[model samples]
Target: MKDIFTCDLRTNSKLPLGGKTIVFGGDFRQILPVIPNGSRQEIVNASLCSSYIWSNCKVLTLTKNMRLSVLASNIQETTTFAKWILDIEGKVGSLNDRETTIDIPDDILIVDSTDPIGLLIEFVYPSIVENAKNPIYFQERAILAPKNEVVQEINERLLKLFPGAQQEYLSSDSLSQADFVHDNIDETLYSPDILNGLRPSGMPIHKLVLKVGVPVMLLRNIDQKSGLCNGTRLRVIALGKRVRKAEIISGSNIGNRTFIPRMSLTPSDKRIPFIFQRRQFPLAVCFAMTINKSQGQSLSKVGLFFRQPVFTHGQLYVALSRVKSKDGLKILIFDKDGKLTNKTSNVVFKEVFGNL
Candidate 1:
């Protein structure tokens, strides 16, 4: 970026950023750049704070909670909730001897439920069958989990409760021709069945089952100008062999209907040995989404399902801060014995905040 700016502006190459000012905005309290199998030190090293340009960067902090400020009726309650969220972000409260575990308040914790996941779904999406066709009902509500597998489980359970005829779409999977030829790998090594089973991050699943009114999220950014970017939620309107029509349920393009055709998508995960392609609809059932994917989104109602405790920095803070108010958030946590508990792990890499 600096080189391009220097050439375009006819400035000296030694000038910082070609004598042009650039602003970077983000919260270090949220998830950092994901390193597949990296250690604690490696993950921190990959952050922008560790970059050379960071030394020249001036840090600016925004202390206001604008989302809570919008609620004029509940100023005190929202202020309390906002402060609690920041306390969790900075690990400000009492901690366990290891300084990793924190106790959750009882008001928002769902306890003593025989079927926790079912109860959580009902709390977030009440009257699922009746409101399945209502786009507005799904627009401001979502369930968040720490892992993709937990999210898939919640989505499947919710889909079963949804009343409609299910349409199944199977993806066509194969190794990329370039990878196959360049690596000189035999085709039989990775059979179609094997390829179909691999569900890499940021790629849709092999078998996608959908109901007409159920909400789905885009896995790939198809058209940004039309507000069809990754993490955008939509409601399925029509199903076809080649394309699926959906109405945008969230973001700036709400109520805009668009056709999404089956496209080829490849996973960008480096842990995968070779490149493979899957031709399928670039969408996933989003009755629940992973916590990492829920960042930068604010919703009226959010369900935090803890199938397991958070294992990385800021996961707890990101999950808790998604909702607009404390009343809009509900959390369900479990111990190894399957009993509901109010204690959960909060992982924070304090070293990242050293320079700040």
Candidate 2:
């Protein structure tokens, strides 16, 4: 993938794998490689099939989806759903002259006039208090939001609804050591307010509000062998000044308790135009998570709160496909402009799939 990103297959003077045959496997429809601040053309150019070596590589595709095959009892519906998803991914839907936005099918849209968050909560996790401690219950359901701000809002609302002890942890936020080397840099430049505003995805916020028995996601891969990895969900059990204890709620290591300590985290956003690091706990409330983070994880039920439409390719597709059954998925579309609507945009760069 790196070779494709750099087009280095044809440009690298020193290359060990230049003579070896390699195999690449993944669904291009799932998620594309993330290139920080890279343009659409740059992203397409960074794909494996876009490299010069792709000319010599044989393209083989597997047509049958094992997931759909296993759910063969509802073959017709699933096949139609899968085709609709591919059309969105391929931008084959009826579009305006620019082909930017399309009218979402009414059958798939959930129209609501009141609070979307409240509606989504009741729809996905009815009787939440009864199953707050049951790890299996949380592992099967989650609300997917498109941005960190919206995820935080939904998590905060759900946290209030969760029945348990409330706990708050404030991060010791500061500029990185590298930023300290410059004597001209003032401490006031990176104040607590500014640091709080810099809550990028994959990094914890300045102040973390938690409650006992509430589910949270690990932000770092503390120990892969222990099933404590990024995106691993856990339920809070105890809290301390230095470490917080949580029971694993997902994966093969369910019910295992582990301690999370303060760790230094750096944001991967080159768009920030500044370099800084944060020292905070590697855990975030998991009542809701950004759609980007929910990729590759299957859920029994999904609540998609679209405060903002998806901005990139594969995001909408990934969010909608997280659930195993169509009946398990529920979407709430709400924007800042007081109106009940279900229409959204799908960004599909057709050229990216040209090699396929």
Candidate 2 wrong stretches, greater than 4 Å: 1-21, 68-73, 91-99, 271-274
lDDT tens digits, residue span 112-224, model 2? 66665687888888899998777678877899987888888889999999997787888776666666666556767778779777877578988898888888999999999
> How many residue pairs clash in each candidate at the backbone level?
0, 0
The 0-to-1 C-alpha lDDT of every candidate, in the order given, reads 0.87, 0.77
Badly placed stretches (over 4 Å) of model 1 are 1-8, 11-13, 91-99
Q: Candidate 1 residues 1-356, lDDT tens each?
A: 43432433465555467767889888888888899888988999999898877887899989898876765477888888898888886742334212377789999988857777777888999998888777799998999999999999999999999998999999999898997679988888999999999989999999999999989999989999999999999999999999999999888999999999999998998978999999999999999999998888888889998879888888888999888888888999988787889988888887777777
How much is the lDDT of residue 158 in candidate 2?
90
As a whole number from 0 to 100, the lDDT of residue 201 in candidate 1 is 93
Model 2: how large is the Cα RMSD against the reference?
4.0
Task: Give every collision pair in model 1.
Answer: none
